[model samples]
Target: MKADVVFINGEVLTVDKHNSRQQAVAVKENVIAAVGTNDDIKSYIGEQTEVIDLEGKSLVPGFIDSHVHLTIYGTNLLGVSCIESHIHSLEDIFTDLRKKAEETPKGEWVRAWGFDQLEINEQRFPTREELDQISTEHPILVIRTCNHMCIANSKALEIANMDEHTPDPEGGIIERDDNGQLTGKLIENAHMQMFKVASYSSEELSISMKLASDAFIKEGITSIHDAGAYGKGSETLRIMQQAVRNKDIRVRVYAIMGSLTNSHDFVHQMVQAGTVTGLGDYYFKLGPVKLFTDGSSTGPTIATRQPYTSDPKNSGIIYYSQEDLDCYLGNAHKKGFQITAHAQGDRSIEMLLDCIEKALKEYPRNDHRHRIEHAGIASPDLQQRMKELEVIPIPNPVFMYVNGDVYKEYYGERINVMYPARDYQEQGIVAAFGSDAPVTFVNPLLGIHAAVNRKSKTGQEVGEQQKVDVLEALRCYTINGAFASFDEERKGSIEAGKLADLVVLSESLLTIDSARIKDLGVELTMVDGQVLFKNEQLMRPSGVRR
Candidate 1:
C-alpha cells in the first residue's frame, strides 16, 4: 500500500500495452504501483518513501541481452591482446602473440581470442610453424570471433596429442594441409576436444563468472540469457547456481545448456531434478536446450544456400544433420522444453524451420515460443512461416556493425538479403534484438543504432534498405526481447504491477540523432525497487530501503 520509491519529472517510455508515455512512476517493494502524471503519483509519496527527481532524463525498461556468453566473455576480460590490436599485417599479430607468450609462464597455456584474418588481409589461418617460432614450450590457442574455429600453436596441438592422423570428429573439422599435416585450425566440435584438454579449473571459472557478473551490473544489465553453457555435465550451471547461492551474482542469469550427445537423458535428469525452464527466482533459471545447426559467417562457415562469394569452393558445413535436429527438437518439445537453435545461413534456417514444422505437426503444443537464435538470413517464405508458427527470431544487430565487412566480402551484392530485418518486420515475425556479447560489445544503445541504421562501425552503409525506425529498434530490445523469453507479462514494460526493472538514460533516445544513439549513457539502473547503479555525481536520498 505504501510507496518504496517514486521517480518524477521524467519522460517514461512505459512500453505498456497502450504504448503510453508518463511523467512519473511509483514503486512499491519491487513492482510498479502507479504510472501517471506527477500529481497522480503524489498520493503514493509518503514521508518515508524515497523520491528521486530524474531531471527530465528518459526512463525505459532495463536492457536485456537475449543472447550472450556470460562466462566466456568474463574469461576474455582477463585475456591478452588481438581484440584491441589492429593487425595491419600478420607480423602485427605475431608481434602481439610473442609479447603475450613472453609474459605468460613457460609451461602455462597462452590464450587469446577475437582475431580476424580478413582484418589483416590474410588468405589463410596462421600456421603452427609461425606460432612454434614464438614458443614451442608454451601451449598457445586463439579463438576466432565466430567461436566456430580456433588456431592452436604446435605446443597446444602436441599437448592435445592431435596429429595429421587424427580424424576429424563428427560435426567438426580439423583443417589439414595438402601434404596431410595438421594446420592448427580446429572447427566446430573439434575445437571442443582441444578446449577440454586445456580447460580452466573450477576456481578460474568462479573468478571469471564473478568478473562477468560485476561487468553486467556496471553495464546496467539486470538479466541476461547465456546463449549456451558448454562442457561435459552441468558444470557451468552448477557454478552459476553456487554464485547465486553465495549472493555473488549481482545480475540474474538464464542459462541454456548446450546440446549433449546424451541430451535426452541429461534433460530428463534435469527435469526430474526440477530444473525446468523458468524454474528459479530472479537469480537464475533453466533456459532452452541450445542446438547449433551451423557455424558462423565470420568464418564463412554458415551453411548458406549459395556458395560463398569469397570462397566459391565452400558453402559452409551443417553441424547437425536434419535427422539429428528433428530428433532433438521433437524430444525436447515433448518434454515442454523450449529450443533455441543457432541458425545463421539460409540453408541452416530452412532446415531448422523444417524441423520445427515437423515437430509442430507431430507433437503440437500451444505457445511453444521456440526461438531461432541468429536467424540471420531468413527467406521471405521462412519469415512468413515463422510468424504462423510463432517462432522468435533473436537477431544480433551488433553483428551488422561488427562483421559488416565480412558479410560484404562474403556475399557481395547479396548482403542485404543476409540480414533482412525490415523484411522480417514486414512479415509480422517477432524479431528480437540482442548483442550476442563477447561476439560484440554488450551495449544496447549500439545495437539499437545498428538496427535502425544498418551501418558498419566504420560508418559505411551495409544494408540501408533493411533498416528499421528508432521506436521499432527500442521495442526489439525491450518488449520484444521480453516476449522472446516469455517474460513480457511480468517485466519488459513500465506498467502497473510489473517489476520496477528500469533504466534512466542521460539522453532521450527518441530525440537523439540516429548517428549519435550509441553515445547515450545510462544515468541510473534500478531493479526491484532498488537503485543498482547511479551516476557517480548523483546523490541518493537518505534512509533508502535496502
Candidate 2:
C-alpha cells in the first residue's frame, strides 16, 4: 500500500530499543508504516503522497511535555510579559502596569504575570505603594514568575477583602510592611484569593488554550499533560471537553485536575457524576488529580529540612502535614485515580513518600504510575524510596537554566542532589522532564540543553555531576514522558505501527555543540500523520539529495 507521506535523506533517530538509526520513514493513515533505508522507503511512496526530504536534518519522535499548565500558559501570553528581558527594573514594571491600567477600563483587573524580583534591577518585589503609583482606580495583580506568590494593588487587596486585621490562612502567608499594614503581597494559598477579582471566563480559557497549543506545535510538542485545569475543575473541564469536541484542541491534552478542585470530596462528586480517566481519546483525556504539598523552591517556600543559607531561620513551609496528605492522597488513590503532587523541597518530597508508602501498604496496587511533579531536592535515602515505590519523578530540568543559582543560594552544600537527573536514571527511576510552562520556557530543546549543561542563565553550574548527555535528556522528554502517561505503546518512539507523531529538527543533538542545543529549531512537527507545523522552506521534494 502506498504511504500517505514519506521522509528521506535525513538522520532519522528511531529512539527505539537498541537506539537504531535509520535514513527514511513512511507514514500511512495515522501510523508509521515503515522505518528503513531511503531505497526501502522510497518504494512505498506513490502518486498523491506528500514526499518531504529532510535535507540532512534530524527526525525524532515528537516531544511530549509531561507536565504543564496549558490554559495558564496561554493566558499569561495575553497579560503583560514582565520577563527579565522585558522589564529589568521596578520602574520598567510600573510603567508596563500603568500602561495596562490605562488600556483596561477602570475597576476591571489589570493583570500581569511572570515578574521575578531577582531578575529585576531593583532586586525586590514591587511594593503595594509602587503598584498604587500605577493606578489606584484599577485593581491590579502582578503574579510572580514562580506563580506561588503575587503582589496585588491596594484596590485589588480591598476587592478581595484582605487587610491587616485578617489573620494568615493555613500554610499561606500575607506579607505586611514594617508598620503592620498589608503590602498586597500574597504567598501560597493566599494567592488563591486573587482569583475572586481576577478570573478567566470559559471563553477566555478556550481561546488562550488554542493560542498556547498553537505555540506548542511550533516548538515540536505533540502532546501536553496539563498540570492544572483552567480556573476550577467543573466549568474548565466542560470547556476543555467542548474544545475537543468542537476541534478547538490544537495538540493532545491529558488534563490533571487542580489540587483543590480534585479534592477528596470533589473526586467522589466527580466519580458520582460519571467523570473519570479514559473518558476521551488521544486528543483529549483525563489523567491524574494534582495535589500540591508545598510551594516552589524558587519562591523559597518549598518545605526543606535544612534552613536556607539566605534565611537561617527558614526551613520553608509545607501546606499539608502527614495525616493531611494521607487523607487527601488516600481518597484519590482509593478512587483508582493516579495522583501527581508538586513536591519540590526535600521535606515535602519526604512527606509525600511517607504518604505514598502508607497508601500503598494499605491498598497494595502495583503499576499505578503515581507521579511526583517537580520532584526536586532528594537526599540519598529519599531517592532510594522513590525507586522502591516505582513513583515517577517528572522533573523540569529547565529550572537549571533559570533557578540554578537561586537553588545554590538556598541549599548551599546540599545543592548536589537538587533536581537530580543522573541519580534518578542510575538508581532505576522512571524520571521524565517537563517544562511546567509559563513557569519556564516551553521548549524541550532548552530543557534538553539545561539537562545536558546544568548551567544557569548566567553560565554558573549548580550541580555539574548530575548532568546527563543529550540522548538521556531526549529520552526523558520523549519516551519517559509517554511512560508517565502510560501511553508509551501508542506514541513516544519512532517505531513502526506507532502513531506518526514525529518532529524534524535542523540538527541532531548528539553531533551539535551542547551549549547551542537550545538554538536548534524545529523544521516540522507532525501529529497523527498530520503536519501541524512546518517551515516550508526547509522541506525539499522527493529524490532531492542532502
Backbone collision count in every prediction?
0, 0
lDDT of 1 at 112: 76
Any runs in candidate 1 off by more than 4 Å, and if so which? 85-106, 121-124, 259-275, 537-546
Worst 10 residues of 2 by lDDT: 259-268
Candidate 1 lDDT, 1-546, residue by residue in tens: 669888888889988767788899999988899999999999998878888787677889877888888877777766655667476766777787788888888988887777777666675668878888989989988877776788998989988889998888776888898999888999877876676677667777788888887777666677788875445437767887898788677676777766323333445455456555677776677778777788887877888888888988888878778998888777777777887788998899999989888888988989888889888877777788888888998888888888887789887776786567787778777777777878778888888888888989887888788899887777788888778777888788899988788888877778888899888887778877778777765434531332
Q: Model 2: residues >4 Å from true position, as ranges?
A: 84-86, 259-274, 537-546
The TM-score between candidate 2 and the true structure equals 0.96
In model 1, what is the error at residue 196, expressed in angstroms?
A: 1.8
What TM-score, computed on C-alpha atoms, does each candidate reach? 0.92, 0.96
